[model samples]
Target: MTHAFYVYASYGFAALVTIVVTVWTWADGRARRRELAALEAAGIRRRSARPKDSLGDGE
Candidate 1:
């Protein structure tokens, strides 16, 4: 009901949101890494491993 209460509540909500987002991002990254490792174990190669064009063109 008071101004201080509202301010503290807003800060608490923001902190909670930040923590949730950080944890989600970290977990997603770990999952992706595991998937990539599994693919590599199956002999899948990345696109960057391909040979580049002799010319300076983007194609």
Candidate 2:
């Protein structure tokens, strides 16, 4: 194979990998957001929503 063929193949492979990762991340994020929304709708609250203790020590 020619040097040009190898270079183009590598570039194409990299691009394909990047696209796959980006799409996977986007879809995962959407799924997580939907799950969170459903949980909230079911009346579940995050830990951060609760009031903290006055003491500086960690509880």
Candidate 3:
């Protein structure tokens, strides 16, 4: 096998891996958002979403 073949194959594999990871991350984010929405609809809330006054933090 030639050096050029190896280099191109390596680059192709790297690009394929990058694309796969990007797609997976995007999909996972969408799923998480959906779950969060469902939880919010069920009256569960995130602490960060609450008003600071409700947290009893000293000003």
- Leading candidate by TM-score: 3
Task: Give the TM-score of each candidate.
Answer: 0.81, 0.83, 0.89
lDDT-based ranking: 3, 2, 1
lDDT tens readout by residue for model 2, 1-59: 99999999999999999999999999999999999999999999787776577445675
Clashes of each: 0, 0, 0
**Candidate 2 lDDT score relative to the true structure:** 0.91
**What is candidate 3's lDDT per residue for 1-59, written digit by digit as tens?**
99999999999999999999999999999999999999999999998899867877653
| Candidates' RMSD to native | 3.3, 2.7, 2.2
Question: What's the residue-level lDDT of 1 in candidate 2?
Answer: 92
lDDT of each: 0.90, 0.91, 0.95
- Minimum summed lDDT over a 10-residue window in model 3 is located at 50-59
**Runs in model 2 lying further than 4 Å from the true structure:** 52-58
The lDDT leader among the candidates is: 3
- Give every collision pair in model 3: none
Instruction: Name the lDDT of candidate 1.
Output: 0.90
Clashes of 2: 0
Full ranking by TM-score: 3, 2, 1
